[model samples]
Target: MEEKFDAIVVGAGPAGSACGYTLAKAGLNTLVVERGKFPGAKNMWGGAYYGPFLHELFPNFWEEAPVERYIKHRKFSFLTEDSALSVDFTTKKFDEPPYNGFSVLRAKFDRWLASKAEQAGAIVASGLQGDDLLWEGSKVSGIKAGGDDLPADVVVVCDGANSILAEKAGLRGDLSPKDMKQGVKEVIQLPREVIEQRFNLNGKEGIAWESLGTFTKGIPGGAFIYTNEDSLSIGVVVQLNALAEKNVKANDLLEEYKQHPEVASFLKDGKMVEYSAHLIPVSGKAMMPTLYGDGILVAGDAAAMTLATGLALEGANFAIASGAAAAETIIEAKKTGDFSKTTLSRYQTRLEQSFVLKDLETFKKAPHFLENPRLYEKYPEFVCDMAEKIFTNDGKPREKTMKLLKQAMDGRISFLQIIQDLWQIKRSI
Candidate 1:
């Protein structure tokens, strides 16, 4: 295929398909290349798709999109060996149109999204591995894939976190383990009614549960479970740097988390359907790579767009937003027929003006705060112990709340450490 196209997007994940779909919708020749058998065939997420990016492209997307469930319930937990302390919330407003988020299985969701690009006149080539950027002097002019050179006026790299094409094009440098995370997950199948009963959900309603502490063996990471139609997605994500210190494998961490009483009870009688491992970019804006250059623009995880603020881990929304922004910038560049760095620099400006960059910048200090060992270690233990102490009833005289808190915290964490962590959390979030 020697045909020169207007735009070639590598990796048909959220970012690539969003770009390709937008470009195609605007009457531009767009081609999306995916390494897997199809889009989402190799992709995985924690089952949450946030934001209205999809709604912007296809109004009322949930009506036909292969969404699992609208998230109406949310829970966060702190875990110790034998106890759990949690905060739970659910709202009826979240179940209506333009819901907050939905649970999704990438294999199905990505394929449906890529089909939208195809329907919009974009060519989606699956099973095509993007090997390297085809360069003309200092600028990328095309993509080299499966021994064929596919030319395009612009190349958008959205090939995920460890984007080899982006790195080879000098758009980003090597990533530090400190800024990366390793995730492993299992998809467990259960009866639809069983799922509803287990998670306490009604029709089309779902829960997103996240926990820290014992799950990671004290690593700087956490575990999550999202309810699907007839299944559950359970996983653990640990910092790459902390993996070595924790001396535990990703699967091992997941296994340990599964044995926790609170988690295991939900999975009873469920059959494991799939298992996968992935690399996650956890640092927010602080580690974002160069956004644009010459005829090439990088979006999604390639630009380190994931946000790992303790309260949430967000990527798909950012990817979708960045992808749309890249397409807009490319549209502007096409108007002038200039794909140089000066023209493509508009992509950076667009992102800055959008929530993609703003949210990242807002939580720029989050990665450091999340990395504090005390959070996943002593803090959770202390909280859980305090909860256990408060709830446990004995014949002996009861201790005051302050005394109970002191007892749980003393020797586990220093007083100064608690104050500092609280201050850091305040400043970071």
Candidate 2:
């Protein structure tokens, strides 16, 4: 007879580990499976995790977690071919305890998080791929891995954005390219003091910078630079459909972005340490998979919980929240000895009542709004040109600001179009 567990979580990423941690802490027999040699070995991101979700889970998690730096500064820039305009902000409040966010290498963070689940009594099985689901009739019963069946009362699907289990469970179909973003990042090593001095920081203070413009070649995505303790994570995230339509490569765009004067100034002596690429689910409510079914639940990227408003791209917190909610729903089901779809559907209700779904629903229009081509092409050029005209003192009679604005708008973008775009931005973000 094969041993069965109360719950099995597929994928040891943020969602899976969080789910396993919560379930095991609740005294349930839980197992977490990861295809990678360890958690986060196959993961990559811009190197930042925001919000208080981790604190809620571990209470001052940053103290013991392998966090690089706390973000005290943020910069957003619009880059034209040869010029840049930016908005930079920093505050002492973000430097206080329980900071707003921190920069982290997923290779370190995910392993630590998986360890937390393990310490809480969840059996973490690394390098174990969950190839298929075991079903008894119409209900999910367990997972089949390495030609062996591991039975469980419930299976939490936290696989990833490209989750095969989600499709096998009839929760979602093949993901559309138009709804995904491809991110390519390079971890550039710099001295810790050099990183702090270059980005203007002191003692664990860090920066997250995002740029939009010709770098992506009008592909409806952007570039990012995040400061780690002794390194920088620089990358570009571009829309998949747009990349194909424009016949452009994301890595080429990253090279172009790196060569930009504004960006190069910060990377003078850095050594390239790591390179990675991954897919992101940009469409929030648009591509969301079915959250629950009989004997199964989906969370994190598998459920399309990422939020990509033009101002920010966030997903880790949503993943953690959804994982906890899934565990909570299962705990309730265990009490009633009912693992039916009706009982598991409380997972969706719990998420709906929490910040996860509320935020995604609130910014549901953002993804479509960000798809506008003008944002990646014309606006950056117009803004930079207008700023240049305003600041340049050529010893001629000065033109009014409105005249410079009109000059910038001429042949690039119309005032009515700007008004409409502004309105769209208002509604979307």
Candidate 3:
């Protein structure tokens, strides 16, 4: 007979780690199985993490976690063929304690987090990919992995974005290609002093820049730059369907983005460090899978919690928070010995009650809205053209600003279309 535990977490990411930590802290038997050689061995992100959730899980997380830098500034830019229209902001409040966000390399952070769970008493085993869910008459009985099976009253799937287990169990369906954002990322290295001097940083303070311009070559994705301790993480994410339709290869696009006049300046002397690619669940609300099944719960990117709002790709916080919730729900299920869909549904309720669901539901349109073809192609060009006209002082009397704006709109977008766009923007955003 397979040994039974209170809970089994399949995937030692933030969500799984959080759940395991909670269960173990409650003194219940818990086992976490991971496919990677170590937790986060395969995870990647353009990755920005909100610090509060981690701080809540382990107070003074900054004192121990492998964080890159504390971000105090954020920049957004519109890029054209030659010029850029940009806005930048810096706040000292963000530079201090209770820092809002930080950059991370998923590999180091995820492993550290899983270790925390282990210390808290959860058994964490790597290279044990969650292979199948053992079902006893429509109820999740346990998790089978690494050619062996272990029993559990409840199993949580935090297996991540392209979860084969979630789909096989009929909790999620195959993802539509258009619903995902395929991204290629590279971490570039520069000397610490060089980064501080170039970005004007003080100690561990950092800056982040996000762009919606020529980065994707109008294929409907964006580029981002974040300052790390001694390196810069920069990359582009494009809509997959748009790429195939445009006959664009992912690597070639990254090369073009890096060479753009505005983007190139930042990399003047910085050397390329690491290159990686991963898929992101870009359709926030539209893509979420069923939250619960008999004795099973889903969290993190596996549940489609990443919000792709303008300039922000948020998933890590969602991972940690939802993971905690799943853990808490299981504790209650353990008390009543009722791991049926009815009892396990509490995980869904807690997740929905948390900001994880509220925020994701609120910005349901942002993912597709940012990817809307017109915003990627028409608006950036229109803004650039308008900027070109106003900044041009050729010694001749220039047309009125409104007249220039109209000219910029003429061939690119019609007056009627602009009116419709404004309405859609107002409604969706």
RMSD of each: 1.0, 0.7, 1.5
Give the alpha carbon lDDT tens digit for every residue of 1-429 in model 2.
889999999999999999999999999999999999999998998878999888999999999999999999889999988999999998888999899899999999999999999999999999999999999999999999988999999999999889999999999988999999999999999999999888889999999999999888889999999999999999999999988988999999999999999999899989999999999999999999999999999999989899999888988889998998999999999998799999999999999999999999999999999999999989999999999999899999999999999999999999899889999988999
Local distance difference test, candidate 3: 0.85
C-alpha RMSD in Å of predicted model 1 compared with the true structure: 1.0
- Residue-level lDDT tens digits of model 1 in 1-429: 369999999999999999999999999999999999989988998888888877987999999999999999899999887788999998778988899999999999999999999999999999999898888999899999999998899999999988998889886778898888998999999999999988889999999999997767778989999999999999999999888765779888899899999889999999999999888898877677788888999999888899889888999989988998999999989998999999999898898898888899899999998888888879889999988889999878999999999999889997899899889989998
- Candidate 3 lDDT over 1-429, as tens digits, reads 658988999999888898899889999899999999999988888867874878888988887989899888888888766778888888778978879888778899999999999999999999999999989989888988977878899899999999877897899878987888888989999999989888888898888888877657778888888888889999888888888888887778788778889888778888887899998888988988888889888888888878777756788899889989988988998898998888878887897788888888788877756766777667888998998999989999889999999999988898888888778677566
Superposition error at 125 for model 1 (Å): 0.5
Candidate 2 deviant stretches above 4 angstroms: none
lDDT of each: 0.91, 0.94, 0.85
How close is every model to the real structure, measured as TM-score?
Answer: 0.98, 0.99, 0.96
In candidate 1, the residue pairs with backbone N, CA or C atoms under 3 Å apart (3 or more residues apart, or in different chains) clash, namely none
Off by over 4 Å in 1: none
TM-score of candidate 3 versus the correct structure, residues matched by position: 0.96
Query: lDDT for model 1, on a 0 to 1 scale?
Result: 0.91
For candidate 2, what is the lDDT? 0.94
